[model samples]
Target: MLFDAGTWSLITDVLAAVFILAGAFLTFAAGIGALRFPSLLARMHAVTKPQVLGLILLLIGLSLRVRSWSAVAMLALVVAFQLLTAPVGAHLVSRAGFRTGKVDESELQPNQMEPDDDEHTA
Candidate 1:
């Protein structure tokens, strides 16, 4: 009985710790990417992608440690809201960056953003 209960608790703690550490690592990577990347789009991608996933992982770890339904539910909502907005916010920021002429046009593909000549023709 002691082994079963105590071991299970220990396992849970270890797993939660792993998740937390991994989440921290992901967030750290995101920060590094945001700082190191040259282009606006690249920087935006770096800041958002891993950051969102890291937030999710961090929330998961918090939920596991709490082990409460209410806490988990709140965390789920947080994750949901983050997931819904992160991409959209990133999109807006990138678009703004592009429109502001901060992004290098040379970084884009040859045909990138080229209007469809056929579409405009009668």
Candidate 2:
């Protein structure tokens, strides 16, 4: 049996709300982490991770509300693009920060870096 307009509207509204709330929460958490993190790399992690997820959630919510194949396909494309770009963007940011000496070595543990090999080189 097909759902009536009223029921379909209610269901769509509820799903949309859920997706929006989840996306908002993810974005808020990312913002908090970016603010609170001690290092640039850490902040990059927070922003990249949650931003992608949040966008995906928001897109999914929008797709559900629209209830059309084209909308869903567009949302899927958006999700795919984000997934492909977010990590590469984060890596580029982190690498740039590292190269520019923007990141504090003191914030990272000594063991995290490779050991000196002067003896082996000699």
Candidate 3:
């Protein structure tokens, strides 16, 4: 046989466990940020960045355990779509939140906000 079933099984399990734990941690952090953040924009930042990454990690880990080229390819496609969309979606949501005055500017650094038009007086 080209492979030892028992050893390979153990290795696969270990890898899966590690991936799951990391994904769980990332998701947990996102949840905490969402709950603890002072504004919608901050919460959006948490979800769009860490949550997306966590999901990608979880999907990749599951694909590795599947050990099939097709599955990995599908997972890669999903990850690619997520990478392309999550940030854009988050940006739209943040802009909506800002326009709606749902965000609290006091929590953010002053420099992060654009200079006021009144401040640009000639």
Candidate 4:
């Protein structure tokens, strides 16, 4: 009743195209940042943040284009797995770098990872 079927279809197609292009741009930027950033933490940040968002956006566009519940469900699962793993993987890598002395303590603010000196006194 609101919009004709043809107009609605056109609108969805336009939106899908916009989402896909934006997602692709963000994914490309993430790759560039991962390669260009000077520090491990910076690279991890680049890989995790924009990469996840780009994947989510790309999947949304795909779901819109496919218009199938099974495909959307599978895409949602992929997004869920990505969201769940990226941070955990980043944390593990950063922790390993910190423990192995690959990470510079000077770059860390506050440096809470260091054991407090007072704990041994008690």
Candidate 5:
């Protein structure tokens, strides 16, 4: 069997473990950041950014170990959906938080009481 029980060899197993552990560590750090960040926007950024990369790493590790096309396809879909939705979710959360006065407005620009009036100013 190519994978015997789970891994093809010690190297692959070790690599998978490394990737998974690193991903888990990043996720843990995100969790900590969510708790330690000063405000809602900071917390949303902490939860969304690293967590997406962490999820990618985790799915990669799982794909390496699982070695099945169907599983890989599903994981791919999960990654795709996450990439698509994470930013939207973060935006919604931060917008709602800002509207609810949970955001740190002092950190914003002097004229940023609302978003820039010029939509093309990016």
Candidate 6:
């Protein structure tokens, strides 16, 4: 009950194609959302979330196709840097937007980041 080498190779190829297509689609969608979204936070969400996932998917597909440990190590480093940086970058952008009043206060739910009048007076 085992696939032959050729069959296994074909299966991996198909799966790799699927992942690559999905990753491409998500990356495309992220671009569209970044352009179309009206708000800074929305654009940030679009850019950070889908792009990171898309990148991971793309790297996974590449690894599957390349089937080389060295290539995978490089891809892993890419993903690691992406994972580490994307969130921090998003947070910084969002905070900058909020502080600069680019984000409308009314749209924020909870709005914990809003500065209190007392703090301003002090």
Assess each prediction's global lDDT (C-alpha) against the native. 0.92, 0.90, 0.86, 0.91, 0.87, 0.94
Model 5, span 1-73: residue lDDT tens: 5567444566676877888988898899999999999878789989998999999999989887787899999
lDDT of 2: 0.90
Ranking of candidates on TM-score, top first: 4, 6, 1, 5, 2, 3
Candidate 4 matches the true fold with a TM-score of: 0.88
Please give the RMSD to the true structure for each candidate, in Å: 3.0, 3.4, 3.5, 2.6, 5.3, 3.9
lDDT of 6 by residue, 11-97 (tens): 999999999999999999999999999999999999999999998999999999999999999999999999999999999999999
Per-residue alpha-carbon lDDT of model 4 for 1-122, expressed as tens digits? 99998998889888999999989999999999999998888998998899889999999998888989999999999999999998999999989988999888889799688788999788
Local error of candidate 3 at residue 94 (angstroms):
0.4
Compute the lDDT of residue 95 as modeled in candidate 5.
93
Runs in model 4 deviating more than 4 A are: 111-122
Clash totals, every prediction: 0, 0, 0, 0, 0, 0
**Per-residue alpha-carbon lDDT of model 2 for 1-122, expressed as tens digits?**
59998999999989998998899899999999999998899999899998789888888888888889988998899899899988998999999999999998878767746767885697
Evaluation by lDDT, superior candidate among 1 and 4: 1
| Models ranked on lDDT | 6, 1, 4, 2, 5, 3
| Residue pairs clashing, model 2 | none
Candidate 5 regions with alpha-carbon error over 4 angstroms: 1-8, 110-122
Q: Top lDDT: which candidate number?
A: 6
Candidate 5's C-alpha lDDT? Answer: 0.87
- The alpha-carbon deviation from the true structure for residue 26 of candidate 6, after best TM-score superposition, in angstroms, is 0.6
Superposed by TM-score, candidate 1 places the C-alpha of residue 43 at a distance from the truth, in angstroms, of: 0.4
Which lDDT value does model 2 have at 69? 99
Model 4: clashing residue pairs?
Answer: none
Clash pairs for candidate 6: none
